[model samples]
Target: MKRSELLTRIVITIFSLGVVALPLALWAQTPLIHARIAEGGGWNPDVIQAKVGEPLYLKFTSDDVMHGFAVGQMDMQPVDIEPGKVSETTLTFNKPGIYTFFCTRWCGLNHWRMRGTLEVTGSETNPPEPASPPLYVTLDLNLDAPHLAEVVPTEKASARRGAELLRQLNNLPTYQSPDYYRLRSSVQVFQDLSGSGLTDSQRWDVVAGIWQSNTTPEGFAEGKELYAQNCAACHGEFGGGDGVFADDLAAAGTASMQTMNGDMAMSMQTPANFSDPQRMLGASPALLQGKILRGGMGTGMPMWGSIFTHEQIWNLIAYMYSFQFDYPR
Candidate 1:
């Protein structure tokens, strides 16, 4: 090699070494976070600080059972940490905000308690505009209030059975409107169809059809997946409020309530049974949306507004109502 060429090659080698060393240096600075069952200590040093528009490196180790880590609302793959093993990942935040990091696995009954926050501060790349209020908020719904349906279908309602009736009805556009469909409960929609001369069952079928129209097969599938991953732990595979964690959740709640008041001590209420027609039929989709986004206050439900996208929330709503209406899988 020529003298000059040899010097150039040496310089290039040194530059590559620096590039590799920079990331290693950053990775070394990150402390190893530990994960364990909720009872043991869900996530140690759960709070983390990072700068916006900068890449972050993290290290994690499982002290007990297998655990997976993923940030809420992020599009990154989850990192699985085996017992006594270290898992490392990198992330970059573009905006300044608080982000949630949670365990993706069901380690135990209190698995939902495995959560942490990432506080990203620095210059905002693009300042986000305020979003409009959710429908439940604008409607001023009392989510905790008892909402019971006066009438329920004698048999399970079917969207396929009501499709033709939905198409033939006058003022159908009014009923098909998104605002109308989301704000009105199944029972309310059935009452609206009263003067149309359809039998009670058919009216409910029409309501089912109306709901089916608002969501697509793709939405339902996505919702089903999301529910399985996030909600099934608490609500159950069939929306029966009998998930593996249900009993434990009730006990945890009851324990907390006992501290609130001695005279009114009572066991915590069980998770809502979506299959209960009387309650599900009376509750509007908007109301369910509110309860989901805001969470069940003091009810052990975690707020998901920071985790799921708006479209995802709507998809969950559609999938949940499937417990009431027979929409084919």
Candidate 2:
């Protein structure tokens, strides 16, 4: 062959190879993140950097038991990370913010502590506006305060009976408002109904009906599933604060109390007992929502603000109140 022709053939071959090799190089560069229980150091290299509108590839594997990987405030479902195997996912962020990535599985008592930050940086055509403060914050609620109800119902408040009573009452539009339901506790509602000439038991039933009206069957189901998946390990299936890790948490708290160094000591309080009518009834939906969003501050509860959406958080709060009221399943 002529020298020119030979050179042309070599150039074509090199171009073909470059096209194929580039993708492989990029794929190989995707980092592998290790997942382990919080006791075992949680996620390795927890802070990940990414660009908005760019695809970020990640590979994950568990060092101990099975765990789940998910990004908060994103619409994707969690990908399971199994021991001795790898799970891969590619995510593209549209907005620029510090997003949280966490384990969805209840791996251990510190499962909620298994969290990391994903720093997504880039300019957006329409940047998101700042969010207003949550209702609890706006209301200046002291979430740590003991908010036990002063009055206890004679019997389990029945939503069906309450619904019947609501039909007889007039000029009580506030009782039907979602805002009222979100801010006022059942005890407050019971007190409000005192002038309606209803017995304390009847007032309790009315409160239950009001709660049922604010939520739907679908919302309850979603809340139930979320609670079982994320909360049942520490809060119990029956809302009695006797979950698998309840005793472990109590023991951890006791051990911390004995430590002389306050800063180093952990606050491992027992999970809230939802079965306690006074406590649950006294807590407004907004209070419960705030607690779920912010988590228990140093109380062994993990912050869920990034993990769950606003509607999902409200749904969870509705289901929580169900433990006190006899709402239809």
Candidate 3:
């Protein structure tokens, strides 16, 4: 070979080696979401947002029937795994947008229900932090959403069924208050959240916030003021259950806390005296708050939920606990 050609070939080889090494070096440093696939219908990661050009190493398996995984834009073919076998595939996404994957197998009746989404984000040196997941109050009954919701065979039916189930479970018909109505209507739809979308514990906290709320006054003085504004009207300015509204309220069944308790005593209701530490001793702050919010559903006791803020409610509860001791009579 000529001297000039030989030198040129050597340089080109060296440069090509560096180019190949560069991408692999970057891949070595890149982080991956590791997960195991089992008898589930969908991908272990149903929803994930990743940077473009990043590799997704899916350690997937299927112990039931044959399963397939495919991404349309990536020109990727479905990787199939038979029953009792492990399967894997490395997909390096080059596009910057949302991509979806689904099981192309008619494994079962819920085969269409098995799908997930992936969001390939644009190239940026420092990506912004992901937003916090919705509170349980925000979780839709439709486990598959926006994109995932489309692929379902009976989308409308699934949504309708899910909505009905939620209403029945939460006792929506008997549940009053505009707040609850709004909440019920908001969660009628569904979304898929099989991936690391939101941890179970976080979802539970959101549920807790929706179903219950409790807060204690910072200290005694604040508690006293809160009591005066909310409770004094019925319980008396001194927490003696002798305010001006007390008599009228008693006639309505709500003002008479003791009587209401007795009428519902056979049931689960336990109306305790705010001033009687013995009666109120075991009552939890949360339980007390719920009791006060709901009132007697079918009875004369109207729900006072609209009248008090969350903070005020807690403070009032604290003040009720304090009623055990007379305020200088």
Candidate 4:
């Protein structure tokens, strides 16, 4: 081969190698975030800063166990970061606000604690309208107070049975209104139906039918999935409050109390038992919505207002009521 031709071929090979290496060099400069259990420092440099309308590149690697990364209230697929392996994601925001990013995988009892903040700064092109307060806030609900049902049903109510009886009843009262149903407890509705000449059991069945009517099959499926992914760890798969993390939560509370003295010690209570007829029947959908959005006062329940959308919360509330009422599947 001629010397000039050989020299030109060598230069071409060198240029090809530089093109490949340049991208890796830039990627290496991107910040590498580390993930671990909440007990093990959670996310290092948990707070991130970026400007709106600019792509934010992120790199993640798990320090201890497998972990999944996702931003709350944002539409993005979760990226799993296996132990000692790296995963990457890109994000862009159009609005300026504090967004939450959390670990999707349940690592331990404090898995929900594995949350970080992303602060985006820029002017909004189309600002959102001011929001109205939730119904619980508007009605001044005291969530911590006991809400007990005055009347308990002798048997589990069925929505299917109620539908049959409802067709025969002449006067369909105002209690059947969806507006009234959202704000009042089941017991209240049952009592309101007394003037209709129906038996106590029939009244209970009517309430079940009303509750089932408020939700659709699609919404039910969505709620079930949300509960399984987010609430099952602490609230149990069936909402009996005997989940895998329930004992750990109680133990953590006890340990916290032991380390302190007097009322300053946190009083973390057991997760709510949705299967309890009395407990659930006494609560309104609005009240439950507040609890979900604001979380428990000291019950180790994390606030999900930022994580779940309004519709998602309502769907979850409807699905929870299914535990108390026997609805036609």
Judged by lDDT, which candidate is best?
Answer: 2
Instruction: Write one digit per residue (lDDT tens) for candidate 3, span 1-329.
Output: 99999999999999999999987786665443222233353555578667777666665666556777666334456787666665667778655666666665545433434656777877755555674432222333221111111222111122223333435455433323324422331121112112324443332222222222222225446667756744465556755667655565455454444666655532222223355433343343444556565555643233445344455555665556444322211
Total clashes in model 2, counting residue pairs 3 or more apart in sequence or in different chains: 0
**Residue clash pairs of candidate 3:** 142-190, 142-191, 143-191, 143-192, 144-191, 144-192, 145-191, 236-243
User: Taking the tens digit of each residue's C-alpha lDDT, what string does model 1 give over 198-251?
Assistant: 999889889998999899899999999999998998899999998878898888
CA lDDT for candidate 4:
0.88
Q: Is candidate 3 or candidate 4 better by TM-score?
A: 4
CA lDDT for candidate 1: 0.88
Q: Of the candidates shown, which would achieve the greatest TM-score relative to the real structure?
A: 2
In model 1, the worst 10-residue window by lDDT is 260-269
Model 1 residue 8 CA deviation in Å: 4.4
TM-score of 4: 0.89
Ranking by TM-score: 2, 1, 4, 3
Superposed Cα deviation of residue 267, candidate 4 (Å): 1.4
lDDT, model 3, position 12 = 100
For residues 173-276, write the lDDT of model 2, one tens digit per residue. Answer: 78888888999989998998889899889889999999988988999888999899989898899899999999999998877877835565337799999999
Residue clash pairs of candidate 4: none
- Report the candidate with higher TM-score, 1 versus 3: 1
285 in model 3: Cα distance from truth in Å?
1.2
Write down the lDDT of every candidate, Cα atoms only: 0.88, 0.89, 0.47, 0.88
Residue 60 of model 4, lDDT score: 95
Runs of candidate 4 with Cα error greater than 4 angstroms are 1-25, 168-178
